[model samples]
Structures are given as C-alpha cells and as structure tokens.
Target: MINMHYTACSLLKITFKSLLTFFAREEREDTMPNTEPKLYKLQKKDLVACILRVFAKLVLFSFHRITMEGLEHLPKEGPALLLPKHCTYGRDVALEAIALHRATGRYANFLMRAIASRFYEWAGGIKIARPKDVRRVPGARALNRASFEYIRWLYLQGEVLVAHPEGTRNPYDMGALKMGVIKHLMDVENEAGRCIPLVPIGIRYRGYWVPFSRIEVKIGEPVYADDFENIKHLLSYLREQISQLSGWVI
Candidate 1:
C-alpha cells in the first residue's frame, strides 16, 4: 500500500534533485583496524558519486521496462531503510534498485563483500567481509562487525539502506529475517538523533531468471522506528507486507 506513478514532466524537475541530495548525508562507525576493508568505514558520498548514481539509474531504466509501485510512500528526503526480499534468480537486488531510483530518485547504500574491485561502488558500496564459515575467510569477524558499524553509520547519516533481511538470496523462500536487522533499529535510534523509517519492499518478476522480462517492485508503507516496541512485532508486520507484495507466502 501507499504507492503511485509519477508523470514524465515531474521527473524532469524532481528526479535529479532527489538523487543529487540523496545519500549525501552522514554516517560514523566505531574504531576499526586499518587492515579492514573500506566498506567497514563511513565515508561521505560526494557530488561526483551522486552524479554517477544518476547515470547508473539511467542505464538500469534503459535496460528494462521495470514496473515500480508505492514509491511515493518513501520519504522524499532524509534517512529511511528498506528491507527488500532478495531474488537471486531474477537479479532482483540490482534491477529493483535501478527501478527504485528511476521512479522515486532515492538511492540505497549497501554493505558489499570486498573483491579486488566491484560494481556496487555506484550505489555507495561499502566493502565487507562475508564468510559462511569463519574458518574459510580470514578476518571475517572484525570485518563483519565493521560492516554492521558502517550500516549503523549510514542510518545515522540520513541515508536509506537497502538490505536483504534474510542475509542471502533464496528466490522462492522468504525465510526468517536476520535478527541483527531488528536489533540494529532498536539499538541505533538513540545515537541517530532521530528515529529512522523502516520500509519493506517486495520484488516479483514475470519469469524467474528470464532475460528482459517484466518485473514489479512493490514498496510497502513504512514501519517507523517507534511504531512497535520490539522485534517480533516488526518482524511479523514486515513478513506480512512482503508476503502480500511478492505473493511469496510461507
């Protein structure tokens, strides 16, 4: 619920401005080792960086005729959070982000795993340590902490973060959400100086993993920081909204 389509004329005046000022705000994480990846640290996204975001959005729009819903419900300015169901089979994360920016002019900062180089930098990408097993990846513990710290920083800075609460993509399953997401919202609000808005998003595609297929992006009404007292309530509401949005019932 709480969605609409913007007209062509409006996009010309509002799109660029929204994208320009978006994610151009604050974030600060605890002290970390210099050896940790840059993703763990909070760095300002400059004007040039935002400009690149514009271009990136355009490319995504041109790539597919994505259908976006409920964009207007998102805050026009300042910080917000989106927990989008991840659809790895359909490239939902990238495609939805692109569609979201095209429709609403809002961009999401993400926690990315460190590679030699990556494509996520366009969206204020932060390098993180991702290890399914601690034995498999060196320095994963500290790096994971750093990534969480930076995520908290992004929320504090007034940037909307797009995250997969399930922590991984399972296109057909909307499993248990990560407890960290719940705790993050509760723990960081006091330091943020404001209660951040937490929104739920759902992405559905015409055909799973089909090339050039039509996709629908559903953005549900926000669940604000103070709306519920604990994680269970927030979690239940989020799952319900996403289930309705994506039609992925558990």
Candidate 2:
C-alpha cells in the first residue's frame, strides 16, 4: 500500500510540472512583443520613384571619380540619421543622397529649404518646410508638427534621412555647425522612446569647379542619441569629427 501511494504521489507531481511548463511557454509568448514594425514595405510606387531619382542624379551630375570609405559602417537594417557637413555649391547634398541610396537599398529623405519644396516635389523627394514659412501657411503650426511626425514615420519605416545641421553650406572657412540636426535627433528619440544611431559623413573635394577632380567620402562611426547631454555638445563633437576627418581646421 505504501509503494502504491508513493507511485501515485510521483505521478501527481509529474502532471503538475507538465502543466506549469505549458503555461510558462504560453505566458512567454504573450509577453514577447514584436520589436520590428512593418512600416517600410516599399510599394510599387516607391520603387518607381527611386528609379527616377537615381536616373536624374546620374544625368545631372558629372561625377569624375567618387571614392567612398567606411561603407561597412552603415547598418544593414533599420533607420538612422545620416549627418554630413554641408559644403558650398550643394555638392555634399547630392553626394549624401546618392551614397545613402547605394549603401542602403532605400531612397533618402532630406530636410530641405522651404524654397526647394517644389524642386523636391518634382524630384519625388520628401520636403520639410522651414520654420519661417510655417507662419505664412494656414494651420502652419499643425503642418510643422505633421512634417516632423512624417519624419519619424519614415524612420520607423526603415528609410534613411540625410540632414545638414548647418542650414547653409559653408565656404570651407570657419566650421559653423547649426543645431538643426541635433534637434531632429532629439525629436526622433523623444517620439520613438529609443536612441537612434547617427552616422557622420565627411565629403572632401580636391578643388572647386574642377569636375572629376576626385571626391572622397568618409563615413565615420555611429553616435548614439544618449551619448551627449544636449544638442550643443553633439554639434560640437560632430563639427570636430568632420574637421578632423577632412583635414580642415575649424
């Protein structure tokens, strides 16, 4: 009788353990959320737009020789801020856009000047309005908010964004860094509740007005959003990095 009782107890314990294991698996599955969102699945229309943009860039610019370094640094997936120093004549802008597209299989969205909206629209690029113009249009405040929301949306969708913190191109003189890029980074982090990586790019031109004179692009390490306390520190660090890489004294 004692042996029978012991066998029954062992069986009961085994049954309880099996039940606990099943419930534990079910609970784990319920708690593990999907981190990746399916927002960036490119539609047929997006592909067409990318093709057109590529064609335009190829036809419009006469790139004599382009050397890209640190291509391996670009992330294979996910959204990132592509920040490059702005040079005179808008060459850096074109280079940034093309390089990003080539490195990552996605078209780049730029935070363009208000006046360039029509041109960007024609080229099938996303246009972000300037602060001054927000006052002119009806419901401008809402539009401004919406534009940023769209930026975050694009990021969530796994698209690349190239922004020049210096609102205007510098003439290779004093390294005057602006806060626009840092502001965008902070805004994105605030909305996403996670720090996005920043990719620093350096574009060097051998000579101005000399086509095919040799363009060198160096993509530096990624900077996390939480690395710096504020935008000032971030901008200062970026400016220094670009200056050092480009061999320019700021």
Best-matching candidate per lDDT = 1
TM-score of each: 0.71, 0.69
Residue 66 lDDT in candidate 2:
73
> What is the C-alpha lDDT profile of model 1 across 64-143, one tens digit per residue?
45778887767767777778887762245555556556656766676554541232344466555544633465666766
Q: Model 1 Cα displacement at 229 (Å)?
A: 3.4
Estimate, for each residue in 185-248, the C-alpha lDDT of model 2 and write its tens digit: 6887787787678888887777654544667788889988688887778878888877765657
Candidate 2 global lDDT: 0.61
Pairs with backbone N, CA or C atoms under 3 Å apart (clashes), candidate 2: none
Worst 10 residues of 1 by lDDT: 1-10
The global Cα lDDT (0 to 1) of model 1 is 0.62
Off by over 4 Å in 2: 1-45, 56-63, 88-90, 117-119, 122-124, 131-142
